[model samples]
Target: MVVGELGSGRAGSTESPPPDSAAAVLAGLDEQQRTAAAAVTGPVCILAGAGTGKTRTITHRIAYGVHTGVYTPEQVLAVTFTARAAGELRGRLSALGVGGVQARTFHAAAMRQLRYFAPRVLGGPMPELVENKLRVVAGAATRNRLTTDRASLRDLASEIEWAKTTLATPEDYPARAKAAARETPFEPAAVAAVYASYEQAKSRDGSLDFEDLLLVTAYALEEHRDVAREVRGQYRHFVVDEYQDVNPLQQRLLDAWLGGRAELCVVGDPNQTIYSFTGADPDHLLGFADRYPDAEVVKLERDYRSTPEVVGLANRIIGMAPRRRGLPGLRLLGQRAGGPEPRFLEHPDEPTEAAAVAAACRALVDGGLPAAEIAVLFRINAQSQVYESALADAGVPYVLKGGERFFERPEVREAVLLLRGAAAGRDDGALVPTVRDVLASVGWVEHRPPPGGAARDRWQSLSALVDLAVDLVAEQPTLDLAGFVTHLAERANAQHAPTVQGVTLASMHAAKGLEWDAVFVVGLVDGVLPIAQSLNRPDAVEEERRLLYVAVTRAREQLTLSWSLSRQPGGRRSRPRSRFLTGIAPESTAARRTPAARAAVVLDGAAGQLFEALRSWRTEAATAASVPAYVVLGDATLQAIAETRPRTLTELAALPGIGARKLAAYGEDVLATVAADT
Candidate 1:
C-alpha cells in the first residue's frame, strides 16, 4: 500500500482528532511503511528506494504521531533538499489532516534560526543575504586576474560553493581539492586565491552567501548554549529527507539543530546519492544505523512507480555497481504488474538518434499517452539541440526541464549575434569555415577545453551552432552565412519558446524526483554516459552507473536506452556503447559478416582498382576538411560507388551518404573524377 504522494488526495478532519485518525493513516501502508510511520520517535532510519513512497511513508509517520498525541505539528521539523520538495511534504501532510508541521529546505531552516539568533549572539541584525554568488565571484576573479567570462566565472562560483559546503577553508582548498581529485576550470592555486578573495569581499561588504547561512547558524548554536536551548526547544523532533545527500557541513548543521540528542529520523536511498560534486556524502546516510545503534531501521522496497520490467532493468544496472562500504544495495521490489520489455537501440549519429527518439515520442503520444507523460533525457544540456529541432520538426510540443533550451542560452544567443554581425558585412566565404571563424572571435576553439566547466559549457553551446552549420551545409551547400542565420531563426521560432503542457526534455540530473510513463534515455556512448571526466577517478565510473540507474527508474511503462555510433555525420563510428552495457548488448561478429573476408583475389578486379581511387579521393577530401577519412565517405559507400561507376551528379546522389548537400558540393568533382577513371 502506498501512503504518501501516491495515496489519495483527500484531507482528513483538522478540527479534532478522529480517534482512528492516527491509526487510519496506517490502514493502506505496507508493513515497512507501517513500521516506519509507527516509530514516531527518535533514532529512526528509513532506507527507502526509488518510487517506494518514501515521501508518503514519512508524511504518514508524522501524521500518525501528531494524531496520536505523541508529536505536535510545530515541533516536528522536516527538512529536505529543495523548496518544492518541502512544499510537497507540507501539502501532503495537510492532505492527511495534519497542519503546523514545519517543512523546509536546510538552508531555509538555517536562515530562520540565523535571523533570530544573530542579534543576541553576534550583537547585530543578520548580514544581508545575497541570493547569487556570481557577482562576488566575478569580482574576486578580476582581483586575481583570472579569466572572468560568464562561463569561467560561473565555474569558479561552483568551485567556491563546493569548497564552502565541505567546510574547506580558502587556504585548505588547493590541498583538499587535490586529495579529492576535484575538477577545476583553472589551476587549484588560482581557484584558491579567487576563493580567498571572494570570502574577503563578502566579509567586507557584510553580506552572507547561501552557504554562510548554515555555517553561521551552526557556529551560533555551537558557541551559545542559550541560542541552542531556545532553538532546540522550539523544535524537538527532526526529520531529514534525502539523507544520503547530506554533506559534512549539512550534517554538522543538523547535529547542531538536534542539540546533541538522537531525536532524528533520516529517510534516503544511498544508491540515489548522485550530487557528490556538490559535496554530498552518502557516508552519513550509510552509517546512520551505527551512529545510533538503537535506531529503528526500515527499508521500503516495494516500488509503486515502475513496472516489474523497468524495476528489473534498474536492479541489474545498479547491481553491477561496486558497493560502497556499509551501503545497502536496496533492490526495488516491483509492486506493479509486468510491462513491455525496455528497448535498446543504436543509431548512426546524434541527429539520427534524436530523430528516431522524436518519432518514438510521437508514436507514444499518438497511442493515448499524454505528451507530459513522456520525457527525452540525455547526459548533458548540449545534446538537447538536435532533439529539440527534431521534436519541433515533428510538430511535437516540449519543455526544457531544469534548464533553458540550447538555442535560447545566452552564450548561444551571443554567438549567433556575432555571426549575424559578420554576415551583415564582408564575404560569407565557405559555410562551415566561416561560421567556425566567426565564433572563434567569441573564444571558440577547434579542440574543446576540459569538460565540466563553465568554459566547456559555453564552448559546447557555440560548438552546437558549428555542428548545425555542418549539418546544414551537408544538406544545403549553397546556404550562405545570412541564410544560415535565417535558418537558426526559423528553428527558434518553431520552438514557440519552450511550449508548456508538452513532453519533457531534460538532463538526467534534472529528472530526479520525477517520473514519466515513457522515458527515452538518449546518447549512451562511452565518453558520454560514463562521461570523459569519470574515467580516471576512483569509483567515479560506478557513480555514473548509479546515474543511469536514476535515469532508467524514471520510467513507469516504456523505456528506451539508446546510443549513437558516431557523434555527427561524417564522424567516425569508432565509438561503442557505454561499457556499462557490455554484458547487455549483443556481441559483435564483424569478421563473419563482412564481404571483405571473402578473398585476396577480389583485389585484382576493376572494382578494387576503382575502390582504391575513391579511397584516395576520400583521404584528400578528409585532409582538406581536417576530418577523418571515413567522414567524407565510409568504406562501404566508396566501394558501392566504385562498383556502380555513377557518371552524373544525379546518379551519384542516388547512392548512400550522397545527400543533396554532398551532391551540390562534390557532385561535379565526383562525376569528373569517375569519368576520367571509368
Candidate 2:
C-alpha cells in the first residue's frame, strides 16, 4: 500500500530506498524524484506541471516498487484518463522490466469488472450495450416532437454526457443546468424532457450506455460487500493519472474502489485544468490534503521540455490568473538548455496573420526543422480556413487535427450552398452587406453564443466566412457573388491535396498532452482566446488562462504568439492583443502614453512600444541594483536600440553606449525585451 501524509517539503536523501536487481531504475532521478520513488508512506499526490517528466517519475516509482517487492506486478492497477496514455504507461513499465500490471482507463477497468460481475449479480446474460449513444439521443429527440438538426443534436449529446458525468439525474437536469449557468442547445425544459425520454428508451431496450459502466460498477461495489472485498483484494494498489480532471462520478468510483483504504497516488497539475465544460475540477487535486488528511504531496516543478524563455513566459501568464494567490509552487523552473526567446507578431488583419504564420512555418522547415515536428494551434477550429489556404498557397503540407478540414464542416457546407444560391439571382449591391445577409440565413448571430456550447462553435465557423468575404471584397471591390463562389472552390480544391507529411493544425484543446519542436499559437485577440462568452465569468476566464498555458508549454524549442488588430486591412485598430499578454503586449493593458512619457523624438508604432518597454525594464533593473537608470541605458540609447531593434550582439554593439563591456553585461536582456515587443 502507498504510505504517508502532507506538507513535508523537499524529500531528503537521508533515507535509502530498498534495493532491487533492477536498481538502475532509480538512477538519474533528481532529488525530488528520488524522494517520490522511495517514499513508502500514505497516499501520494504529485503536482506535476506541463513538460515535467511526471510520466517517467511515476513509472520509475512503480517499477521500483515491483523490484523491491513492495508491490506485486499482478496486483497493481494504473488508471489513466485516456487510452493512449494508458498504453504508454504499459509500454514504459515493460521497458523497466516490470509487467503484468493492469493499466487502463476508468471506463475500461469498470467495464472489465462489469463483464465479470454483471452475469453473477443479475442472474442472467449482460444487457446489450448501446452501440451509439448519439443515435439514441436523436431518437429520443424525435419522440419529444423537437425540431432538431445534426449540430444541435451533437450539442445535446454533449450536454447529456456532462449531466451524467456530474451525477445529475434527468429529473434534476433543468435545475442543474440553471445552477451551472449552462447554455443548452434547446430550451431547458425541452432538454430535460429529451433527457428523461432518452433514459426511458434505454431502459426499455435493456441497454446500457458507456457512462453506465462507471455508475453500475460503483453501485455493485457499494451495494454488495462481496464485490467490494473482491475488487479491493484483487487490486491492492491504485495510481490515477490526470487526477485534476476527475468529475464527481469518477471520484465516486475511486472512493468505492478504495473502501476507506489509502493505496492511491494521483498525479496532476491544477494550473493545467482547462476542461471545465466537461466538469473537470482542479479542486480534487488542490484539496487532496483535506480529503485524505494523511496524503503526501510532491511538487514536480522542474520542466524538462521547454527552454527558460518559454517557461518564464508560461509562468507570467499563469501568475495573472484569478485566485492564483492561494496556490504556490505552480511556477516552473526550466531544465533544458536555453533556446530562442518566443516571438510576438502583430498584423493588420487575420489574413495577414495566417499568411505570416504559414511563412514562418515554411522558413523553419527550410532551415532544416522537420515539417511534422511543427504545429499551428488556435483558440477554435473555425480559425483554420485561412491557415489552410495560406499553407496550401505557400506549397506547405498540413493536416487538420481532431476532425475534417474546415471546408468539410456541415455548417460551412450549408453556408456555401446558400452562397451558391445567392450567386444566381440575389447577388447585388455592396459585397459585405450582401454576404452578411446570406450567412445570417444560416444562423450567424450578431452576438456569439456562450462558451462550451455548440452554438458558439457554429457561430465561429460561420463568422469566419463573413470575415473572408470582408477580405475578398476589400481586395476586389467590384467582385460579385459569382466570383467569390469561384474563389471558394479554388481554395477547397487546394485544401484537398494529400497531406501526410505536414504540420498539425488544431485548437488549443486538441493540442494538450502533445509537444512540438516549433509551435505558433495564433489569434491572440481579446474575444478569441478568453472568448467573448467567458469575459464576465471569472472562473471561465481563469480556465481560458489555463488553456493558453497549455498551448505555451507545448513547444520544445521555438515558440511564437501572434494576433491581428482587425478582421480586414484598413479596418479599425480597436482589436488589442489579448489582455492575458498584459503581458509582453503592454498596449493591451496600459493606458495610452502620456504626452510627457512619449519620446521627445517621434518614432514609428513598433519602435515607440519597444522604447517604452526598455525604459520600464531599465527602471526596474536600476532600482534592484541601486544605480541610476541612465547608468544602464540613457534615453538616447534606448531610443536608438528601439529604432534599430538590434537582434544580435554585433547589432547592439554598433549602437551608442553599447560596446563589448556593456554587451557582456546586458546584451541578451536587451534583445529579449526587444523581442517581446515584436
Candidate 3:
C-alpha cells in the first residue's frame, strides 16, 4: 500500500479568505485529496490513478493557495496536455471563485510567451504558425526533386514531428531513428534532408509550425535571463496535469518556466502513459520525487469514475506488466457500487463483431441509456469504418472523434466565410445569386471526384454543404444573405462537428480524458490490440498494454471487450484473443459468442422488401449524385418510410433526417418508389 500525508482539519490562519469564504474549498475532498490540495507551499508530485479526482484536487489547491494568501491567482500557472483539459481546469477554477490563474496547454502557454517576447528577443514578431505542415513538406520535397507518394509524404511528416519534439536535429535523425527502432518508409537521411528543406521553406514563408512554438520558447528562456525572470516573476506557482505524456521539449519549457524554483506540483499516472510514439517520456513523472527531494508525494487510489467490476478488470490487466523502479503499481479501489461484469465477446469475422457491437449499443440506448452516454473505441482510425456502417445500418446516430468538424472543414469554412462576406453588401432578393457566386469562388461545381479515396470524401463533404445552403434558402424564403450568414455563423459556433447527441465512435487514443457510461472496446485480437508492428519490441508491447488499460478505464458502468477470430466470413480462426486477457480473472468476466454464419432477420416481410427497394433506389441516387447513400436518406429514415408507407410527399418529408431540400430533391422519387411497391 502507498502512503502520503493527510490534510489537517484546521484551516490555516495565514491563508487569505477565498471568494467562497463561507465554505472551505477543501470541504468535500477525501483525506488524501484535501492534503494534496492544501500542500500549496512546496514541490509536490501526485500519482493520480484512473478516475481519481486529480483535476478537482489541483483546481482546489490553486483556490486554497489564493484563499490563504500563499499565492495570488495571477501568480499561478496550470498547464495540461490538451485544450479541452485546460479549458476544464480554467472552468473549475472559475467555479471555485479563483480567477486570473493561467491554465493552458504547453503549446498555448509557450505561444503566448513567444508572442510577448519575440519582438524583444528575436527582433521581430513571432512567425505565423503553419497549419498544414504536410503540404509544406510536400512542396519542399517537390523542390528538392524527391519523388514520394502521398502516404510516404505523410509518414515523413510524422517523422519530422517526432524528431523535433525529441529535440533531435537533422543530423541526429538517423541515429535517433535507429535507437527508436522505427521502420521508416524512406531513408532517414533522405527524410532528414526533406525536413531541412521544410524548415528553410518555413523561414522563407515567415512562419513556424506547431513544434517550433515550444522549441523557440525554450531557447528564448534559456538565452535571455531578463525574459525568464519576467515570466518567473509573473507566475510563481506551476501545476502540470498528465505529466506522463510530456515530451522532452515540453519538459525543458516547464523547467525554464520554473527556473529552479520548487513551487511546482505535477500529477500523472505512469501506467497510463501511451504516447511513446510521439516522443513522450513517462520517466519524468516516475522520477519526480528524485528531482525534488523535499517534495511531498501523494497517491490517490480511490477511483471515482468506474464501477467495482470495471476497476477490478483494469487493476488485473495493469498488474500483469513488469514493475519499474519509483513507479509503484496502483490497486485501485472503486468508490462506486458494482455493476454488470465486463463482457468478453468473440465473433467469427470483423463484420460480425461490428454487427454485435451495433446491436449491443442499440439495446443499451433502448434500455434508457442516452446514445451520447455510450461509445465504441477501437485500436485505430481504420477500424471505425465498419462500425460506422453498422451503426448507420441500425439507425443509430454517432459522432466520430478526431474527424474534422463540419464547420471546421476547409471547404465548409470557405463557403461559410464567402456567404458571410457576400451578406455584408447583398439584399434578401440577391441571396441566391450571392450563394451561387460564393460556390463558384470556392470552386464547388456539381462534378464529383472519381469514385474512391480522400478526394471522394472531400467532394462528398462539399456536396453536403451545398445541400445545406439549398435547404436554408428553401426554409426561409425571406431571409437575406446577412440573415443567413448570421444564422450560419451561430449554428457553426454552436454545433461543433459530430453533434454530441449521438453514439461516440473514436480511436482509443482520442478517447483519453473522456468517460462513457457504456464502452465497447472492439478489435481486441492479438495482432490488432498489440498491433503487429509492436509485437516484436517489448517496450512497444508495454505501450500497447497501456493503451488497452486506457481503453478499459474509460467505462463508468457497462464494459465490453470484443475480438474477431478471422478477418473474413467462413475463414478459419486465425487471430487469437489479446494476451492481456490471460491476466483477467475468468470468474469476473462474462463470455459471449457470435455464430459463424447468421442470416438477416426480417420482422415484417413486406416492410423489409420495401426497405430493400428504398435502399436500392438510394444507392442509385447516391451514385448518380456522387454523394454517400446516407446523404440521400439515412437507413433509419428509409426504414421509417417503409414501415409508415407514406403515400404523399408531405408524409415522406415528415420522416427524420428529411428536410425541405431533400423533400424537393427526392420527394417525387421516394413517393414513386413507395407507390410502385404498393
Candidate 4:
C-alpha cells in the first residue's frame, strides 16, 4: 500500500514518505506523490498542473487502495480515456504489485458488463457492435437515397450518439435537435426518423454501435434494480482518468456501478476537456466537490515535467479565463524554475515552418534530448503531413497518427468486412462492401507499390488471398459476409497491428495523457489554436485554452512553441504570434526591449498608464509600425515601462531582455517617441 509523505519544498531527496500500512503501497514515489497516493478514501481531487506526476498519482493510488485493504483487487474499476492509457495504467498497476483490477476504456468496460448480462437481462444473444459507424451511416444514407458526404455521415452518427447519451429517444429527438448549440445537416424530424430507422435496422441485423454499448447497459441497470445492485456489489471502488471528458452516459454508468457504496477517486485536469463537441463535459470534473460535499480536494501543485518558463506562460494564458461565478479550486500556480524559454518562432510559411520545426527537433535530440522524448503537435490531423515530410527528409524517425493514410488501409478494412459479411447476412446491402473488401484485402487486384520490393511482395500475397476469398464468396451467394470478415479480421488482427519506426506525430487532441521529454507545439495562431470554430463560444474558447494547456503540459523538459506567417510561403501578410503569448508580457531581455530599470522614480496607477502609452509608442516607432491601441501593449510590457521609463536609447539598450537586434531596429524611434510623449 502507498504511504503519505508530507510537503517539504526542497527539490528531490528532501522528504521521506510515511510508513505504509498493509493496505497501502507507496514505492517509486517522491514525498508528494506518496501523499496523494495515500489520501484515497474520500473524494480526492488531485489538481495536478503540467509536469506533475498525474499518471503516477493515479497508478499509485490504486496500489495504495489495494495494499491498505480499502479496496479489494476485484472490487476496483479504473477507466481511462483511450485504450492506450488503459493499457499503460494496467501495466503501472501491475508494476506496483497490484493485479486483477478492472481497467479499460469507458466503452470497453460498459460493453463487457452489458454483454456479460445480456442473456439473463435481455433474454437473447448479445448484439454485434458495428465498429465502423461512418460506413454504417454511409450505407444507411445510400439505402435512403440521400445525397450525403462523408462529413454529413459523420455528423449523423455524432448526432445519434449525442442523443443516445442524453437518454433521448427518437420521439424526443426533434426538440433536442432544435435546442442544440450546433446544428446538424438533417432537420430534427428527419434525423429522428433516421435514428429510429437505424435502430430498427441494427435490431433486425443483430448489430450495435459504440453508443449502444453504454446506453443499453445504462438502461438495463436503470430498468432492473437487482442488476444495478449486483453490479454495485461487485465493483465497489471506482476511479476514472480524464474525468473531465466524461459524458452524461458515462456518469450514469458510474452512478449505477457505484450504487453509493464505493468511494470514488477521479483524476482529471478540467482545462483539458476538448471533447465537448462529442458531448463530453468538464463540468463533472469541476463540480466534483459539490457532487460530494465531504470530498477532500488535494491540489497537486508541484510540476516535475516542464520548466518554470513553460509553466509560467501556461498560467498567464489561463489567467485570462473568466472564473466561473462561484467555482472554487480553479487557479494556476507555477512550480518549476529553470528551463528553456517557451519559443515563439515565426516562419515564412508552412514548408519553412515544418522544416524549421524538424531542424529544431533534430537539434534538441543532438543536444541530448531523446527523439522518443520529443513530440510535434498541431491543431488538426491534416497538419501532420508537412512535419512528416520534413522530418523524413531530415532522416529523423517519426510516427504519424491517424493511420498511414486512410485510403492505404482499404485492404485491411476489406478483410474485416468480409468476415463481418457472414454474420450480417447477404440481404444487408451493408454486407456487400465487406465481401468486396475481402477480395481486395487478399489481392483480388494490383495495388500501387510501396517503396521497396519487400513491401511489394507482402501486398501481392495479400492481394492474391483476397482474390481467392472473392471467388469463394461468388460460389456461395448466400455466404454471410459479416462472419467471413470477422474470421479474416481475427486471423489478421494480430499480424497487421500498426507500428511507427520514427518520430511520433499526432494531433494535439490525440497527445493527451501521453508525455515526452521535449515537445514542439506548432501552428499556434489565432485562427488555428483558438480554432476559428471555437472562438465565439466561451466554453469552446476555454476548451481551446485547455488544449493548449494539454500541449504545453506534454513537454516534460524542453518545450518549443512556433507559428508561421501564412499557409503558403509569401502568399499572405505576416501574422503575429498567438495572443496567448501576450499573456507572458515583457519576454526576457534577449527577445524584447523594455526600459524599466533605469528610472529613479516610481509611477502610480495613472502615471503607470501614461508611461505605458509612451513606451508602447516607442515600441511602435521602433517596430516602424503604427502605435496600436493600449490593449495591444500587454500588461507585462506596460508594467516594465512604468518601472523603467527610459529617457534615452542607451538606457533602453542597457535594460534587461533588450537585445542588440531589437535596439538597432527600434531603439532610436522608440526613444524619440517616448521622449516626445513625456
Top candidate when judged by lDDT against the true structure: 1
Model 4 C-alpha lDDT per residue in residues 108-203, reported as the tens digit of each score: 888778877888777887888898877776766676667888888888888888888777898988987666556777777777777887878788
Per-residue alpha-carbon lDDT of candidate 2 for residues 596-641, written as tens digits (9 for 90 to 100): 2422222246766787899899998889889998788765567557
Q: Evaluate model 1: give its TM-score.
A: 0.73
List where candidate 4 sits over 4 angstroms from the true fold.
Answer: 1-24, 27-32, 171-178, 186-190, 325-327, 330-337, 365-369, 404-501, 574-576, 585-678
Collision count of model 1: 1
- Give the alpha carbon lDDT tens digit for every residue of 1-678 in model 3: 235501112222223454665248889999889888888887888889899998999998888888877786777789988766776787688777777778788888888889888898889987899999879989978877889888888988999999998999988998999999877867888888888899899989989998999989888889999888788888788999999999998998888888888898899998899999999988898888778777888888899999999999999899888997775667789999989888765555687677666766765676568887999999989999998888776556677788777778787787777777766755455566667667777665674333433444455556655555667779777767787677666556434232344688999999998899999999987888899999999989989999999999999999988777677766776677788887562321112322311212112457557877988899999999999887898654665566557776755554555689999999999999988899
For all candidates in order, the CA lDDT equals 0.79, 0.78, 0.78, 0.65
Consecutive 10-residue window with the lowest summed lDDT within model 4: 5-14
Candidate 1 C-alpha error for residue 553, in Å: 0.3
Clashing pairs in 2: 3-41, 3-42, 4-41, 4-42, 5-294
Per residue, candidate 1 scores C-alpha lDDT tens digits across 276-370 of: 88899888988887788787778889999999999999998988877677645688899999998887765556776676567566656655687
Ranking by lDDT: 1, 3, 2, 4
Error of 2 at 7 (Å): 38
RMSD over all Cα atoms, model 3 = 11.3
Clashes of each: 1, 5, 4, 54
TM-score per prediction, in order, is 0.73, 0.71, 0.75, 0.69
Candidate 4 displacement at residue 11 in angstroms? 41
